[model samples]
Target: MNIHKISAATIARTACLLLALTNQLLSACGKPVLPIESQTVEQLVTAGITTVAALVSWWNNNSFTAAAIQADAEYARLKQKGE
Candidate 1:
């Protein structure tokens, strides 16, 4: 028997990474990311941000306060909108 423990933050980041990667696959392969090339810049930016965010999240995991603050903020944001 085995037990698997997954934190909410890990799950959230994984989902975000997966979605970003899928969107990047659609955007970076010269497909129509947006209505125009300039507009597609946002998609590229989002891909970059997700990569950075994931790395930052990993780095912050070593710090309880930082990770907790981020998690708390996300929780409050979601709860405010009834998510």
Candidate 2:
């Protein structure tokens, strides 16, 4: 059986959820408040978004490269006939 490792982005988002739940529990109990940095959530969102954008960019580049190569090959074949 093959097991897929969970991604960092998923872990980060899970941590964000845990942080929220922890704070809620703490506040309800009247315990000492913990400091929750907004940066953690912001960074996680940025990481997830940038990862998706990069994958899309990579796909576009690979397809464009393949098409360019095919066009070059066709151009060469036509040039040979014109000679």
Candidate 1 pairs with clashing backbones: none
lDDT of 2 by residue, 1-83 (tens): 99999999999999999988888899788762575468976998999999999998887635358788898788779999995
**Candidate 2 lDDT for residue 82:** 100
Candidate 1 lDDT, tens digit per residue, 1-83?
89899999999999999877777787778663433476577888999999999999887645359778898889889999999
Q: What is candidate 2's TM-score against the reference?
A: 0.38
The C-alpha lDDT values of all candidates are 0.80, 0.83
Off by over 4 Å in 2: 35-83
Each candidate's TM vs. the true structure? 0.36, 0.38
Count of steric clashes across candidates, in order: 0, 0
**Candidate 2 global Cα RMSD:** 9.3
